[model samples]
Target chain A: MEEKDLVILCIKGNRSAQSELVGSFAPRLLSLIKRYQPKSLSPEDILQEVFIEIFRDLKAYNPEKGVLYTWMKTIAIRLILKTRRLDQSWLKDKTVPIEYSDAIPDLDQILNKMNTDDIMKLIIALPDGYREVFNLVAVEGCSHEECASLLQIAVGTSRSTLSRARQMLKEQYAQMKIY
Target chain B: MENNRKDWRDRLDQNESPMDMGMFWNSLESKIPVQNPGKKKRRFLFWLLFLLIGSGFIGTIIIFNKPKGKIAGQTEQQKNAGVTEARESSLSPIETQHAADEIPTSDATAVISQNQSSSAATAAGDSVHKALTKYQSENISSVTKTANTSDKKTGNNSNDTQIEETASSGNASPIKEVVSENKQDQVFGIENQNIEKNAMSTAHELAQNSMAAMEYLPTLSGELYRELNWNMGYVPTFDHAPKLNQEKSGWQYWMDLSYGIGMAQHAFKTSDPLTQSYLGNRSKYESTLESRLAVWENRLIHPSGFYVSSGLRYQTHITRFDWSKEEVKIEWKLADGFVQDAQGNQIAIRDSAWQQYREMREIRQHNTISSLDIPLNVGYIIRKKQFSIEIAAGVTANISQYTSGKQLNFQEQPVKWNATEELTYKKSNTGFGASAMFRASWYPTEYLGVFIQPSFHTDFSNRMNSGAGYEHKIDFVNIQAGVAFLLFREGR
Candidate 1:
């Protein structure tokens, strides 16, 4: 059955369709959560919470705004952020300045050398504040202001954090080449 | 650099992770709570609504049925009165014959006085005596002879002779004309004297026969008088006779106050399936209490009991409804705009984030409609002595209706499902309606009465023009007990 039909059946309390709906979305949601969530939280636990929320609020979903996957992805990101406590007030004024480098690596060489998992690992290894700002602003296509509001930090702080995160990635990439 | 960032973001979006979905589904399904779908509450509300409508109809039926038995009782009472009159007439002739036999002994006067006194104790009997007195005054000779013979047999002959002498002295000129005619008869011969004696004997026989007929004559005349009085629309007063002017048809005015309970019914036609479903599932109609005060004037069109009445009434009707539960979901599509932060920095929101919020709410509503009604009714009145009953049917023109109620406003964007909006029914203005009333009244005085009226009214046009995908019309049955004070009436 189609995703929308499965969603409607799940809302009507059909058990088999509910299981199918959960099966269809759980792996994709777990993958999305794995990218954003802390390593301390279990992938299964985060996926469990996202699926529960999806079934609970299935009736609230409108296909007009976006597709079902995009909607569920948004919910998964919110749950991951909330579970990790990344959007809390503790990130206030935590931005660190990065020294500006004269010779930056070519983006094409960096892209060709690293796999997607390696790039994801590089993002996950950043500090909580830098990683949140970097994910929201660079990966999620959010503006600096949106990233600032989402992280509860100043726009200038968000801008500096992303710059510092890029510098750190460049330093790591150069080191990797030397090895 | 911006293009490089965009390319990296696109790359991140394409990334996916590999996981075992079957194992994850088993764990996730175990944690979700199961919901029980039951319609117990909805079923209870439906039964309650059904009972309310049923009771309203039953009560109206009972009220209409009551008047029939009461009318039958009134007819029975009239029949009993007629029987009593017939009995009196049947027994009266025997009493009159006995009085005639005692006339020579002067016991007839005593007997007649005794009979009149006995009959005077009852209202019907008193009317009978009055009718006899009127008849006696018109034809005096038979009654006068009987009176004279009774006096002579009682040894009051000297008193009778004195009465005659006094009468002759007062009418000496007529006595002289009678004496001259007698002398002319004497000069004519013995034959003329024989003719005079024969005429005297005939007059004596006629007087005897008239005395015998007088018994039944009084009873017939008495009954005729009562019939005439009733036909002339005369309501006999305890203090005196009904006046001549009161017999004519005229205007009667009174004021009435009433209270009752009624129910509301709704009919809907909509092209929107959602609206139709919501209305079908959620709308519960309930009974409402009402009150009315009015002043009416009836023009008695015929003495045979037809009248046309018109009144101005102010009435208030309340209708209660429970709308079905609805789940509302609103999706906000944010546009890119600059909003000043707490620090007064303009932040551009480039990403259009979709925020989905849902609410479940049930609407309970009370609609009160107050209106001024002008009713034009034509009715037939059955008037009996101090009581009257009128059954009237008419059209009532609603001059103005002011409706105040809680309504759900779904058309406004950014819907607040929990908040109720006050709606005024603008189309509730002048609408024509039909009404029927059964009024039973008792006149305690000449110009004052108390009445119990069971009335029903239904709108010819819809009472609500909400344009909210539903049309509503209301019909109500009201059992109103009220007092009527006649402001002006033709005196009788």
Candidate 2:
């Protein structure tokens, strides 16, 4: 059945339709959760929570604004961020200048050489503040202002943090190439 | 680097992981709880129907069981009877007089029946002739004189002799007619007097019945044993006094406005060590200004000394707290950042050379909290002749609260000293409080009284926010003296 029909049936309290909807969206949502999940929480646990909230609030869904996958992914990302308590205080300890380095490798070369798991591991190894900004701005395609509001920080801080995260990723790739 | 960033995004999109749907479905299916929306809606509708039916049944009972007095029924019957009697009395006057004259007499055997009827009819005609004579004497006396002259014209003929014989017969007829008319007039007058006497007797009986019914009527003061006797002068006694009677059992209202000074003690409880240390040894009782206006209703259940008093009271309390002057040292450690020096110049902080600052200053803090509370209470009063003692306990709802103060905080460089901050506790900060008071009042006049009340009040619920890091409850004891004016009473 189509996604719209599945949503209507889900709203009507159809168990099979609800299960189908969950099954169809689970992969993309789990991947998003894996990117933002803190060390303390399991990906499966976060996915379970995300699906519970999605079903609970399904009745309030308006289809005119966006597609189902986009809406569901937004819910997953917000829940993961809230569970980690990623406020502006996360940026307090780490302060670095956004200067370009000669030793940094080209991002295109690194992306071409790296597999999906290697890239995911590199993004995960970033600092809590850098990883959040990089994932939201660089990977999730949110604007710097949007990332600032989501993380409750200034727009300037969000720009500087994204710059610092890119530099750190280039330095990590240089070290991997040396190894 | 910008070109590399654009290429990295494209590469990131190209790497999508294939998902195992069966495994994910099995896990999610186990976690999702089954929902029965129809059953939930039906249950809600059932309760709503039940509530509506219950309220309707209660309304029906109340409407049907209400008191319906007999006063309306008695007045309606009297009105109908009066209307009938008035209609009968309003007939034409001539018809009623003729009816009176035609009443048959029992002496018909002594005289010819036809002669008796003719004589009664002639008597009525003679009365009409006498009325016409009196009316003609006023308006046309000359006409009578002319009739006498005409009699003289016919004097010497047989017609004159015939007139003389007829006149003589009419002379006897006039006397007999006068006697018969007098008897009929006497009978009509007796009937009129009998109708008036019957009406007066009915009126008298109605008045007696009304007075008897009043003896059984319910009194406004709920005095069931008292009887109203019309035969005796009804002086209002204390036992059967009206509800508004100040000397008896009824609702009495008074408005009292009072202002006084009180002392309050603060008790703090907290799990946070920093908040606990911040409020250390601050257990001293502080003075507060208290003002209250209350309208009280005292219902005296009987002529005896017991009464129940309840009312709405509005009170405002102003409490001041002064954290005494103390000297303290402040310290700050800054990492790689820009800091302002005493000369207001920015200096960069490096990892090798960490920036540190210290300052010492004396701090004095003052806080004031104003609160408005509305309390409702019920209590019993013990009264002697002109004095009463009352003990009341009730809950007060704290409706509004405001707290303003000057405190110290640490910003980037130097500690901000004595910052004026308006701190508002949450709406949950004001909760229901309990109070108990003892009042001794003396009534110098029927409408005025003086009283002194000592009251103890404390919040039964946590009136302060737990998220403020420390929980604090305040209690106060106040002794207030004020004059009360009796605004109204249930009965006059």
Q: Which 10-residue window of candidate 1 chain B scores lowest in summed lDDT?
A: B173-182
The top-ranked prediction according to lDDT is 1
For B345-453, candidate 1 gives per-residue lDDT tens digits of 3344444544332233444556777878888988876665676777788899989877777764232223333446775754565799998777777777766677877
- Give chain B TM-scores in order: 0.48, 0.38
* Prediction 1 TM-score vs. true: 0.40
Clashing pairs in 1: B282-B324
DockQ of each: 0.10, 0.10
In candidate 2, what are the lDDT values of residues B219-311, reduced to their tens digit?
100111111111111112333322322356667677887666565555667553223333434423343435454545444344553455555
* Native interface contacts retained, candidate 1: 0.24
